[model samples]
Target: MDKNISFTLKIWRQNGPKEQGHFDTFQMKDIPGDTSFLEMLDILNEQLIEEGKEPVVFDHDCREGICGMCSLYINGHPHGPATGATTCQLYMRRFNDGDVITVEPWRSAGFPVIKDLMVDRSAYDKIMQAGGYISIRTGAPQDANAILIPKPIADEAMDAASCIGCGACVAACKNGSAMLFVSAKVSQLNLLPQGKPEALRRAKAMISKMDELGFGNCTNTRACEAECPKNVSISNIARLNRDFIKAKLKD
Candidate 1:
């Protein structure tokens, strides 16, 4: 049986993107060990509502760790203290009976906090819109086996495709660089045959937009990979650099 535990939550509170932020303390008592972090927040919100206090604002959707909407910095780690997991997947059992857990939004200039724990991650969307897709006309959807992609290449592409566009990389990076995220996005498509035609253009455009959006340059620190929920590799960044250089050389 899972035992209940008590803890103190110091969660960041802010009214808007331009407003100053600070931590608001709340006492959580007798919470089930199996309760997910988000569920615990829900209970806290319920308590606040009953007491007529304003509820904490946070972003979440598809709590199964797919959408990457539950971006949070718990105890100085992006997405709590779990390895290869998102904040929604984090359970209370990870913490002891009386621990002070600090929760904050992703602290990056590129990802400005919108309210409390939620930030505007639409910068990622803008990067994607810059050149994350294959626009060439393929007349019809071909059968899966028709393309004849080798096992190794296909596997690498699949691994790169696993990136969920979570901004944990930005939050974990000391430079606030989006190289890991941008590289993963570029690699997944560039490694495939359908995306080969415009690979050079894709690399240049996405990287340009990332810079235009104020994301810092990659400085070889692997902090982003260390804190990534999907385990996206830094090697993709190397590949991105090679492609970007090739694009520049051709110009």
Candidate 2:
């Protein structure tokens, strides 16, 4: 059902990384049901600019949810209250007409707020470069049938490969653990035949890089799985644990 909502928005505002931040409130009337969370933010920004105030700055790219750039901590929930939905996919209809929504950036030591709602998640990219991808040759690529991966292994790898590295797992976790994200990335490669040659190496290198980046340890609390937009299994974390142990033993 389409409805117009009148809500009060409380958004975090900051000038830069070292600046003191505060919550700024704005009220709007007749917000439509079809307006996305970012769309709502857009409306608020337009209003703020009209008032000669700086608009709240947040990260967003490819509003279709693939880019994983719309990292919003909305009303105490990462990516708002929508299950399996990114911030860009969140609509204002989910909120009450008189709701006061609190919007902020992802809070983690590794993901510090750069300005207002925009944070630096490039730490994830650094960890990936440390060891998230497979190392293939510059020579001719193998044929699709050359690898001949069995269905079960391929499917499992695909499932793990679905991780978007959105860092929701880290944000939702009490200890700020990134096990789900790292595990999925590691397990995806480890599950496949093509990934076998560097399986142990990949596990060891990725985990080491993760630790070096100062990500907190997992305590099995499962807040990560609960908030993972991709629904990545915690069992993959177990797989990473086992792989890490095996790699250490082989050292």
Reference-based TM-score of each model: 0.98, 0.96
RMSD of each: 0.9, 1.2
Q: State the lDDT of candidate 1 residue by residue for 101-220, as single tens digits.
A: 999999999999889999999999999999999996658887988888889988989999999998999999999999999999999999999888989999999999999999998998
**What tens digits encode model 2's per-residue C-alpha lDDT throughout 1-251?**
77999989888988888889899888889999999999988988898899998888988889988888888888988898998878888888899989999988788888888999998888889888877888887988778787788888888888888888888998898887778998999889889876778888988888888888888999999988888777888999999999889989989
Model 1 residue 241 CA deviation in Å: 0.6
Model 1: pairs clashing at backbone N, Cα or C within 3 Å: none
Error of 1 at 48 (Å): 0.4
Q: How many clashes in candidate 2?
A: 0
| Predictions in order: lDDT | 0.95, 0.87
Candidate 1 residues lying further than 4 Å off, grouped into runs, are none
- Please give the lDDT score at residue 159 for candidate 1: 93
Best by lDDT: 1
